[model samples]
Target: MTLGAVAVLASVLAVSCAGVVLLTEQALTADLDQAAALRARDVASLLPAGRLGTTVPGAGEESSFVQVIGPADQVVSASANVTGQGPVIPAPKDARQVTVTLDSSPLGSEPLRIVAVPVHLPSGPGWIYVGTSLVQLRTTMSTLILLFTTGLPLLMLIVAWTVWRTLGRALRPMEAIRAEASQIGHSDLARRVPVPPHNDEVGRLATTMNAMLDRLEASSRRQEQFIGDASHELRSPLTALRTQVGVALAHPDPEHTRDLLATIDQQTQRMAALIDSMLYLARTNRSPPGSLTDVDLDDLVLEEARRLRSIGGLRIHTAALAAARVRGSTVDLSRMLRNLGDNAHNHADSTITVALTTDNTTAELRIADDGSGIPPGDRERVFERFTRLDQARARSSSGGGTGLGLAIAQQIAHAHAGTITIDDGDRCRGAVFIIRLPLSAHHGP
Candidate 1:
């Protein structure tokens, strides 16, 4: 980039210097031409008055000279510098003025600009010639050429060096960022690029890069944790199935084999459920919702209540369900409700209450159980994948809870542009899992 900038500047400077040289030479030449014309007119004026002398005062001087010629092209009078010179220039023909330049004249070897003017001489029609030296103009042009020829290179060098240094400093931070980023892989996401101190474009770039790195590191940690937890969770059912199969094969008793087979079937279902949940999570995290339709949130609540009642142990209540509607994927919403209901059934003592209500913009669902409420600090942690509270672990295992129910519930809620929070908002005994989803534009019964 610096080299390109220098090249462009060099072209501009070359054109500008050439223009200046041409303009300076034209101006100097115009001035010398004007002076010579004036001298010729003055000598011509003296001729008509008959006061013209054999030699003019400025004759043979370095500044100007004059000569007078007769009609027949003979030198009638001359300047001291060109006493016998050939009329300085040929006399005018048909009373027309003529002008020319002499490379070498009787005056000197230097060049001269001569102007011939037709005059009405008392003797007859003749011509007067005036000459101006071109030494000053030539010297000025040579000096200017020398200065431009020498100074332009120095100026271009200075400009190139300046652009190089400026661009180097400007890009230094980006180089550091690139070097650091090149070293960072998925395993090294924790590292961040160094930030420059000044709040310039480079500094802002470093800040954004560091911010992105922070997010990538956090996501990497969450992914690693989820993978580890998923592996551990899946291994339990696999191990139980393995052990049960081994026992059934070793012992040939019919009743014992049947029980072992039943246990194996149960373990297989649990593994399937766990894998399905993991797949659902992966899909939700990676892509957007496929389609959406208006869903009756209150209907989902009553459905979960009926499901819990079908399980027979838990008393289900859905008294406060109001006509609430939301726009979301029905399958995802149903999965969310099922997960929440299963969680409540597994943890509730005897009563699981489900209620949904809606206001102007939000449809809120509350699912509460009568079991031991979650601790304040663990409320948020309960939504993490494969997280089971100590008090509920045994029940989770016995009831075939995948430990992904709440996490899946939360994911679905967020996919529907909703939020889930565990709170005692309704003064429930156990943790009240409240989900708030945006109300459909047109709500109906």
Candidate 2:
């Protein structure tokens, strides 16, 4: 338990008990004082005035512990042992009887309560002072105090122990998890935190952590594989470039050197394209967290089509729809559009049709080309990095592709919680790339 909780609990318990104790004591003392005053008034009125004041040194004085006040507020009578002692509690001033006390301390007197009363004698309404011993009351109060003082520590100790034990049990699983997690790193992604059987907040936290670890492990493996494959792909072109240069160097013929230089230039372009695609892929993974913004998909597609149409590679036609939007990073969205446009221009035998439209729930952009269509079975596989459609690689000049354009496009689409799908193009044996984003991207009044 925290010290603060302990202090609060202790204070609450003590205050509650103390209030009840004090109230009980006050009631008892008031009752006793009233009883004492009544009896004293009766005893003093029955005695003669002078005789009440007369003192006895031995037997009478030893037991004498009372006092009597006259009507004029004079101590006309007193007990020898109690003379001028105890509070000078005033006689009742009004006709209606009331209770009052002067001492603030609980143990102010051996008899804590005293009272004064008026007695009607032949001379006048003389007053009588009455006080009783508080020895018995003191004994009772002392006993109660002793009981509270003795039991309070034991009660708090039990409470503290219970709280401490509960807190430890609650945190034990997390401690074990922390220790196990400390030894786990990139090499030991297989290790996982043990989630307990109970369904509690802590259990939920452990489950979430375990799920995160699993995702990280899978992502790490994929990254490693990508790096290794990229390295191999880059090395192959460089090796071809070196081989061509070596052959030209050995022959020293001008025609041979020119052919070798051309071959070297081709290989260099291939390597450059590969590196550029890899750099784009790296950018896809380097997307800033929490950077999504509303994007106008309709305007973007029409703009891209307009820009590509002027290049004269292939006629870019657009059938744009209004208010086609999504929430995503502008950089990734532009890259996705640029890659789709590049791929469409490269493969299209004639015209590239860019269609932009939206359903009530989703926005879609379709880029279709008038070229040989991809087989249904190979459509999905073609989007993978370094994947080529055999024939696409054999094409001349700009038509030949490194096969990363589609992969990069898919990655950017997925980053925006969207998907890219392929279908048959209209009036052509070509493929259509359909990219869909949720309509939640449309943030408007």
Best by lDDT: 1
Q: Model 1: residues >4 Å from true position, as ranges?
A: 38-51, 68-79, 91-102, 116-128, 169-176, 247-253, 256-259, 292-328, 345-373, 390-400, 416-418, 428-445
TM, every model: 0.80, 0.73
How large an RMSD does model 1 have? 4.1
Candidate topping TM-score: 1
Clashing pairs in 2: 110-134, 111-133, 111-134
Please provide, for model 1 over 362-429, each residue's C-alpha lDDT reduced to its tens digit, 9 standing for 90 to 100: 99988898888888999988898777886446534322287788898898888888999998634646
Estimate, for each residue in 1-445, the C-alpha lDDT of model 2 and write its tens digit. 5576678888998997798679878877877877767666556555655443344222122312455555666665565665555336666777443444434322343344556555664456765655555566767887887788788778888888888888889999899789888989899998999897888988898899999999999888878878888888778787887777777677678867667777778887777777887887887688642477787777678777877787786877775555666787776787789878878877788889887777777788888999887789998998877677864345222212666778988988888888999998776489999998887634442
Q: What TM value does model 1 have?
A: 0.80
Looking at model 2, residue 192 earns an lDDT score of: 92
lDDT of each: 0.82, 0.72
Considering only N, C-alpha and C atoms within 3 Å, which residue pairs clash in candidate 1? none
